[model samples]
Target: MSTDFTDARLLDALGTLASTAGAAIMAHYGGASSIKSDGSPVTAADHAAEQVILAGLAGLLPEVPVLAEEAAAAGRWPASTRMLVAVDPLDGTREFISQNGEFTVNIGLIADGRPVAGVVFAPALSRLWLGAGSKAEAMELPPGAPISAATRRRTIRTRPLPAGGPVALVSRSHPDAATSAYYAGRGIGEQRPVGSSLKYTLIAEGEADVSARFASITEWDIAAAHAVLAAAGGEMTQPDGAPLVYGRAERQFRTDHFIACSGAYAAAGRR
Candidate 1:
């Protein structure tokens, strides 16, 4: 917890690392491979991108520990956290390998087991989203190279959900038949096929109405976006309507599916 590393400073650093990581990922795009604990493909890009972000985070916040995706998958989790950085340095590696370019770099800071700040960067698309808990602004910055990212910052916010016919952004990569059925069950109109954590960001910006994830997912996948979505006037919650929570025991991470929707939806539902 370096007081010197404010949310703005961390996001700026995250932007720089994301650019470097994205570039590293590009080099190994379709040709990368590493074995996961379960023998799934980890990819060279995952390690390369993670290492770059991890080192940068360490340098920027010398007292903090990072619980990055690549590192956690490798059995390197952090302990005793007043502040923790969650990094999905290359989300959507499968999409990246398939060349769909829907991947992103996710960074989140948790205090007392809840996110206080976060950043998500989609490199190939050259887009970035970040938030500073309650004290600073949440924003979106367009794509730029790593070396030139420090100067670019743009503010962003969610518009109200439409009067009707709200758009639904679903998982382009992981939608199961049941998930599709769930959306259909909700009478959702105008579905957009998206990948990675971009689903929540879209909801935060009011481009989409809700996200119903009926399948399994990890905390690292959604926590960062959860922070931004909350700041942008949205909620990520379990289907039972429980508020989304993080930093539970390890088993909970894999089972934490959630739905994200506009602030109005909850109030409307209650009526």
Candidate 2:
């Protein structure tokens, strides 16, 4: 909670918390799911994982307020504050129900409308990523292993766009016609379809060069991975090229259209 905490320490805490939540989510994997009031599907895994993450965050940083998906959907939100945690215990619920192994547990810290730290854990894939400040890393979490015990962490960064072309990552669930038209107009290379915030992480890890979102989305959907991408030397901004700001009171945390890109792709957009 204190600014004095180094990025490494914050990421470590977040990784641990996210790993715990991932375990909770896996417990309900492959089970029946119910629809929430908003028409989005919800499973016991979502609630159970949220509970684990919330408790873990409270224990790790009691001073920091938490805004979690389940709680927020129930009309529960923390008071207006610059510094707080945003969590999506089960992102990609449809993927989970379909057993596609793309869902993730996301936890992020937002300060002054910017994501400063975050952790994204995909239990189904046993992959975890952490980011804070200007640093980011990826590691594998063996089945039932705690994140604190994860070894072989590799520092991650975005690669420059190739001379031939740039690869784009797009949403699997909500592909937009405008996004496709934008890519075509920009002469983008291959496009990859992925679920959840993993698209952002793929770009951060240099697996893809850019991601453009046009559909309706909430802060919790992207904040954590946005932090990781930013920390990995990538950038996320509005289509008009302004930096994305979080913690909107009027919009109830919804996000506008934005593009997340590596430096090379960002430069290409400028051109």
Candidate 3:
């Protein structure tokens, strides 16, 4: 298959699914009556969005396997030897349930344990970010604007994390107590919270220098962001100071603890 096909066609398909699902989510925002899943709230929007993503992916890339969040948790890990796609039909379920608007539709093309292309669309916020290979780039989309980037545009790059007072991005919902304590006990900088894998952009664009997470994350959630961050002069690695890699054959497919950083944070994993 042509890599270019994955670049434009796949990304476009993902953007559409995300946007459509986001609309479904917004329509159900703040409705009463509760049915929670795995201790987290589950709204009609979640299933609707997942179904849309799943159906679209199946139609677009009929050959490649799909590992979607909702399905994966329910024992639907794709079994493709060649390549497969990982989809977070909706990331940040809490944010979506809370109507806080940080949720996103994440889709990544994973081949031989690496992300070839990733599309993250926050429909409610009208932002679209896609990254390919080792180079990830992020862009914002005006609400109701065409998804194509031929019109308005901006680029992203990593700025060094402040020294002695480093700026950090922590999880908005699933905070890692150990990671937080590690930074605070080390007497480092201030921490900011955001939803999903959006923290990758902070270090990528120089807004924040370091983002550490010891809590569980899936490969689909970080693969595309990893590419973008790596391309923007940053690194994503395990807390043990190893570069992040994929294709592990775990049933759960949990990602190890990692830190994304510009300059100063590049070495934090070493300690």
TM-score of each model, paired residue for residue:
0.86, 0.95, 0.84
lDDT, model 3: 0.69
Off by over 4 Å in 2: 1-6
Candidate structures ordered by TM-score, highest first? 2, 1, 3
After best superposition, candidate 3 residue 136: deviation in angstroms? 3.0
Candidate ranking under lDDT, highest first, comes to 2, 1, 3
lDDT of 2 by residue, 42-77 (tens): 999999999988887777778877778999989999
Best by TM-score: 2
lDDT: which candidate is best? 2
Better of 1 and 2 by lDDT: 2
Which segments of model 1 are wrong by more than 4 Å? Answer: 1-6, 134-153
Q: Which residue pairs in candidate 3 have backbone atoms (N, alpha carbon, C) closer than 3 angstroms, thus clashing?
A: 136-228, 157-204, 159-206
lDDT of each: 0.70, 0.85, 0.69
Candidate 3: 10-residue stretch with minimal lDDT: 143-152
